[model samples]
Target: MTQGSARTDLRIGQLNVAEGPAFEEFYEIFCEALPASERKPRELIVALATRSDYYLLIGEIGGRVMSFAILYLSDRYPIALLEYLGTSAAARGKGLGAEMFRAAIDRIGSDSLVIEVDSDRQDSGDLEMRRRRKQFYARLGARQIPGVEYRMPKIGADSPPELDLMVRPGGGRTHVTKDEMAAWIEDIFRGAYHRAVPREELARMIQAMPSHVDLIP
Candidate 1:
């Protein structure tokens, strides 16, 4: 279907366990789109699905699923981590990804949303792809968390994984101080990543961020 028609016929909602076909499609497509090192095991996906904080949303057009988004919402705060978002290759470049994102941000009221992007690394040759990915989010009004050296925990044996934390204002203006950044880091580590960030590492990460900074746009 065309982009305009897809938007007109679009339907977005949580991907519950009962939606077997949709969920399977999402998983299969996600596996194809993401690298093995970056992808999570199917069991983990199932486990996270049972939790209230984790959300898996499926976007469908005329009853056929086309995209998926995985979000982790903080129970104590109005913040969310956009874990993964993907559209089937056949349906890409037709605004499905952006449409699903807009719906998600609107649904969550975008108080504070965090997403990770690959950092520029000399050895990693996908620098341009990473930059374009950042630019895509920038177009969506998300900005990099300035002055922070964020290191994503190694997932699937990839050592020294690095990522840039990007934030965006959803409902209102935002002021991200060091303490707030710390809180975000803590929550993401424990809640989303399912691992505790070491105190020293956390301290270093927080220290890299300025004592106070505003990333709202």
Candidate 2:
């Protein structure tokens, strides 16, 4: 997809291979935009691009890569996880992030897209930055899924970071049922995390979910 305006002309699409200049450019921005704790090893990320269910979307302008998004499509569920998204420092403040997000959703064509954001409830990092990130998604129609504490799967030896799970419902939906949310979570734990998360831990998290999860602003 392509979006053109006075300030930017962005062309976004999926990158199937993990090599070449575009992939290299995407990786450069990925490493720079996301902290070590929040990202997986370079090899593992590259491997995911080879999978049928995973998509690596890249956005560029005038043939220069400037942004990317990693989307995980669950085979057993009608949901996709927005695993990682980043815009190069040089491309910041040009509304590329939001455009990339919408392009990802459009490419996946899923009824729901789940994203993980740093939690304000915990001192994960810069609180103000976290607030701004949440607000950014909010403006794009994503809302927090309250009553549950969400965490990213552990990267290497580091413990998982607490994050807020927000969902953007498509097809004119307003909420997700408990069962649907539970399945999506389990799919994420198994498909996306490759069952790296312990079964007992997964059970505990699901057990704490509310019956009806309303996306709240």
Candidate 3:
């Protein structure tokens, strides 16, 4: 297991097997950090566990949730897409979140990282915090890809909703030609976005691509 030095006063350990009733202890951390959530930590963890491709890890201090991140792998894109991420309200300024992230990077080992931030953050103050997340990825030399749409039908998305794509390239796949890129995007959009994309729109978007543009899928 990878370990990073953290504040001595803080317990700074990883969360393990928190899907059961044991999560009650960590409930306050979620309630305090994410008021928008309807249930406690354990309840959410149980629901999240049922989803395929999702992974969860956390940081705790004195039995409180100090930091946590959720990752879900795409069917076609090997990228690990970070979903829910939060640091305790009390532990915001500490290196707890960074430590958790570093541990994730170590576990994934040079695999690409991808995540979406609500473009508007209109629902919560997390938008600003999400910017910090972007900075975090940048600090690790992750590349952010703009102008990409994130449509997830598995999440019951109905439109070709657009979100910026942040990518940490690790596999060294060469950039692909425009046509190839379009095909690649189509495949992932189908897999990742599912029914959210209308078939006609998918074809139109891929077919209209300029020949010279290239992107790595």
Candidate 4:
């Protein structure tokens, strides 16, 4: 499950357990790269790694952990969600992020992979960084799932932030049907978010989806 050329020395694989030095290293990188509002508690992350459907992909080089991806594979849906992906600050610009992304997709082995990115419409001060993030994923072949007003589930005391849903469609697929999108969202909310999101909020988001969701370039 690891991927790398001899020249790069990169290695990517799933970290099945939430204990020990490896898990601690991964957690360090995770906490360093993500804001508290965007991260799950360490205990919850540990608990999730024990699930059959969760794949915690950790990337390393020369035995040092550098990147990670949190993937949720849902048995009830054909799509998988890439909930979080990050590279250590020192690992940036070395292509580890893209490598981790590919590893997550390979692990999912699904025709569709969903991702949530901060919406440009939000007044978050990091607009420039958000734009670059969207561009990064776009460069990696993801297309925005237009017409759905996506938002993250509330965490702690922070309000949910607006997000844009993107899909990396496989098998030459170009779009998703309304029903398919709704089902995927439901699966993501229940399985990935663990239903931390209220049922009414989920329904409202699903209702906002268009009949045909085009992958906008």
Q: What are the per-residue Cα lDDT tens digits for candidate 4 across 1-217?
A: 4666333688888885634777888999999987777888888899888898888988878787888999888888677888899999998997888888878777777458899888897677999999999998999889877667777776656675788888998756777887787778877878877775566766676676678876645
Total backbone collisions, model 4: 0
The TM-score, computed over Cα atoms with residue i paired to residue i, of candidate 1 is: 0.89
Weakest lDDT window of 10 consecutive positions for candidate 4: 1-10
Model 1 C-alpha lDDT per residue in residues 1-217, reported as the tens digit of each score: 1233236777788777777887788788788777766677798888887998887877888677888788888876668988888888889888888887776686577567888777764457788888888888889888888767788777776564577888876667567778888888888888888899999998887676788777764
For all predictions, the C-alpha RMSD in Å is 3.0, 2.5, 5.5, 2.3
Model 2 agreement with the true structure over 85-155: per-residue lDDT tens digits? 99999989989999889888787774688898888987755999989999999999898877657777777
TM-score of predicted structure 3: 0.63
Q: What lDDT, from 0 to 1, does candidate 3 have?
A: 0.53
Tell me which of candidates 2 and 4 scores higher on TM-score. Answer: 4
Between candidates 2 and 3, the TM-score winner: 2
Model 4 misplaced stretches (Cα beyond 4 Å): 1-7, 196-200, 206-209
- Scored against the true structure, residue 188 in model 2 reaches a CA lDDT of 87
Q: What are the per-residue Cα lDDT tens digits for candidate 3 across 90-174?
A: 6787777677666566656655666554443235556775577678767765555443444333331234233445555556644
Candidate 2: count of backbone clashes, pairs at least 3 residues apart or interchain: 0
Stretches of candidate 3 exceeding 4 Å from the true structure: 1-22, 25-44, 50-52, 120-130, 151-162, 173-196, 200-217
How big is the RMSD of model 3? 5.5
lDDT of 1: 0.78
Task: Please tell me which model should have the higher TM-score, number 3 or number 4.
Answer: 4
